[model samples]
Target: MKTLLLTKEEVDGLICMHEVIGAVEEAYKAFNSDQVVQPDYMGIHLPSPRGEVDFKLGYNKANEVISMKASSGGFIDNPTAHGVPNGMGTILLFDARSCALTCVMDGSLITGLRTGAAGAVSVKALARKNARTVSSMGTGNQARMQIRAINEIMTIEEVRAWDSHPDTLARYKTDIESEFGIPVVTANSKREAVEQADILVTTTRGKGSLVEADWVKAGTHIVAIGTDQQGKQELDPEIFRNAKVVVDSMAQCAEKGETWHPLNKKIIAKDDIHGEIGEILVGKKPGRENDHEVTIFDSTGMAIQDNVAASRIYQNAIDKGVGTFFEFFRS
Candidate 1:
């Protein structure tokens, strides 16, 4: 048996934000149509570095995309102690018809790209169609990817960014502004960046809340990508509890995402979460029914998303011979 190996750089070179957004939208549609099967993810904590690894596996039968993903690494103690990244992962795609290994993709790039695309999907589904401004928290790879994905979907004229590190935020502002052709501003505070923005995206790994409920407006749409961990949170859960909250998966949200702690504390009930994003995408439920409704998209990340996006990029890479080939078994 032979397998195609895609390095991180190769996989990064293959993905585009627009394509990823399309992939996410398609996955959600298939999920809503009952064409995809997914299992709840499991978490494993690494002892030495004090981080957690997650597993998400799914198959979209109609779309012919199958994948299992394991993402880990968060050595928060030191910035550059290891030569590797703070997070690392890979995607293994299997052919639905043949059950054969189709591709092996670098997970880090896939995670960032797919997560950003999910944010883009939420923005498309919930944000005002004519929105032109976006405020983003955190100045990392996900932040950059979010800017790229959002820019692909909307005609964003300006992006405001905030980070605890002043120098990093400055560089991020310069780089993203130049790349996306949007004026980027560095804000003095999270509230300053969040308020008055048509759309806001939170991507930090911080454990404390960054955006408050009062700072949000009537028509604002928030996409919170940070609070995927049990103790980590970036947005006030009151905002989520009060708004028409949509999650990637209700189960995952109740277990690990922003809704986890609050749910455990009984601040939010099972009925509090409106529905899955797939339901809204498939038109089984309405999204943003009124202009005055505040919407929050809680993205904990999903495996079906990785499989769908990775498979698409992998097929393109195969046709272009973008990655190296190796044999896994010899008969």
Candidate 2:
């Protein structure tokens, strides 16, 4: 069997913001329609200075995609040392009917694109249609991808960002403004960045809240994407309480996502959450009940998203005649 090997650069070349947003939207619809089979993610904390290892696997029957990914949390210690990313991963794509391996693609870009697209999906489902201003926290690759995804779903006129590192924030402002043809401004503080924005996306991995409740406006839609694991936080707990919260997966959000932080602190009760995004997508629940209502989409990053996105990329690569072929299985 010929296995397709796609590098991160190739994967990046193959995907665009519009395509990723559409793919993730399809995945959300499939998930809401009860067509995907996803299992609880399993994580293992390696006893090492290297850090924890995480593995997640899932299949989407409607989209005919399966994905398995693993990441080692060590590369961030010295990002420039190996000319590679801190979070490295690989996604295995399979034939849904035959359950045979079809391709192996770089997972780092897949992770960023899918998660960014997920944020876009949330924006589409929850944000006001006329939302034109965006505020982003963090200046990492994920933050860049998130801006790309946001632009795909909305006609964002301006972008504001703030980071601990001034150099990174300055670079982000210049690069994003040049790329997106939108005004990008660097803020002095997280509060300054988030305040007066129509949409806010928190993509930092800070262990404490960088977003405050008061900074967010009544009609702002907030997407918290950084806290996909326990102990990670980005938004103030009071923001969650004031806003009607929608989660990708409530069960997982309770354990590892942004909601976990507030829940543990007794800031917001479980029932206070409106519903899952899937439920809202399926029409089982409502989204953005009123423009004045502060809406939040707590994204923890789900396996179904990975499966659907990787599967789409694999098929696209095949159709476009991209990726290197090797005989992983031969007669």
Candidate 3:
């Protein structure tokens, strides 16, 4: 048997935002139609401070592919101590019928792109048609990808951003302006950013809520992407009280994502959730019933995202003859 091995650079070259959005959107539709099987994300936290590893696995029956990704994060000392990134991951792809290993590839870049694409999908389904002003919290790599993905679907006349690090915020402003030819405004506070946004994206890794419910406007569509862990939170619990809450995965979000906080506190019940993004994609449920409605898309990264994304990248690599192929097993 031969297996394909792809590096981060190879994967990045093979995948683009346009294809990623389409692939992720299809994965969501498949999930909504009961054509995918995904297990709950599993995590193991180290006793040492601020370190953990998690894995997500799923099978896309429609595509006849199975994927598993194991990733690690919150190792803050890695950069200073080891001169390496704080987060890293590996993705494995297998044939559904024979369960044979088909490909092994870098998953870190895939994770960021798929996650950004998920936010873009929500923006397409929930945001108002005329949304042009975007507010982004956190000027990190994820924030950059989020904005790029949004620009793929919306006009994005202006961007307002806030970050605790002034240097990072400044760089974000310069980079975005130079790349997109749009004005990037550095906000003094999170509220300022939220108030100026037609579409708001929160990608921070804060431990507590950085946004207030009162600051959010009625017609705003917010994509809360930072709070994927138990203690992480980016939006106030009150935001979910009256907002049309759409989660990536109800079962996973109820346990660890942004929905967990509100659900655990009884701020909102299971019935309060509008529906999964997949349901919205398949037209099983409505999205953005009115412009005056406040909508929130709580994203807990899903395994199907990795499955579809990896599958697409794998095929793209094969078609383009990008990645190296090696014979691993002898008959």
Candidate 4:
């Protein structure tokens, strides 16, 4: 049998943020309903370049496909040193019945889109219904993707962004304002950005906490990204003491995500976790009970997200005849 192969650009052309968001939402439903098999993700840290490679593998019974995504990022010098983007990855999709490799495609773009979609999913379910302002930390690739995805789910009246690099923040403001036709401004400080947001997104890679607990205001929904690995702290654990914390996967997040720090430090216990995002989506639990309470969605990323996304990409490629096909297993 032949396998389909697609490059990053081809994959990007095949799927968009809106489709991926809907797919991600469906994936979470299957995940909690026991229609998907996903193991906790694994991460390997590199000392030299200060990077991380993460492997997410899963099987979707509904789609009858298995997939694994290998993604790497955080190499600050990659643009100059490797002549490549900082984040890159590939996805291997297989047929469940035959256990044969059916598709090989670029995963980096999917990774960014799925992640951005995940944040939007959380906002749709957990954030305030009237949220019109979004504040974010770290204006990079994922930041752009998140803003694009969130705009699809809600009407963002304005966007405030903060980055340690003034030039980066300025560039992000310009690019966002130009592309989305929205008011984009640079925040003078992290507190100024976050406190003003009905939804606060953190996408930094700093080893220490970036957003203080007190900086967060009531009714604000925080999406904690960039904490998929151990020791990556973006929000103060004290926030957990007051905010209703929901995670993509409790088993994964307790050890490797934003929830890990608070659990280890005794700031909050496992039982304090409100529920999985899937549970909220499937109506097993409630979302944002009151407008006055704060909420936190700790997104460590999910294998189910990768599985559903890859499956959709493969099907779309086949339908559109968009990629190269080769019989790599031919005798």
All candidates in order of lDDT, best leading: 3, 4, 1, 2
Q: List the residue pairs that clash in candidate 2.
A: 1-329
lDDT by residue for model 3 (88-205), tens:
9999999999888999999999999999999999999999998899999999999999998989988999999999999999999999999999899999988899998899999988
* Candidate 3 residue pairs in backbone clash: none
RMSD of 1: 2.0
lDDT of 1 by residue, 1-331 (tens): 6789999889878868888999999888887787878998888877866688899899988767679998986756545676676778988988788777867878888888889999999988999876788998899888888888888888888898889999899989889977877899889998899886889898888788788889998888988899886888888767766688888888788888987765776767888778999999988888887777888888898878887888888888988889888877676
Q: Give the TM-score of each candidate.
A: 0.93, 0.93, 0.97, 0.97
lDDT of 2 at 105: 86
Estimate the overall C-alpha local distance difference test score of candidate 2: 0.84
Of the pair 1 and 4, which is ahead by lDDT? 4
- Model 4: residue 220 alpha-carbon error in angstroms: 0.3
Better of 2 and 3 by lDDT: 3
Task: Evaluate model 3: give its TM-score.
Answer: 0.97
Candidate 1 ranges with C-alpha deviation above 4 Å: 48-50, 76-82
Candidate 2 Cα misplacement greater than 4 A, ranges: 45-51, 78-83
Evaluated with lDDT, which candidate comes out highest?
Answer: 3
Which segments of model 4 are wrong by more than 4 Å?
Answer: none
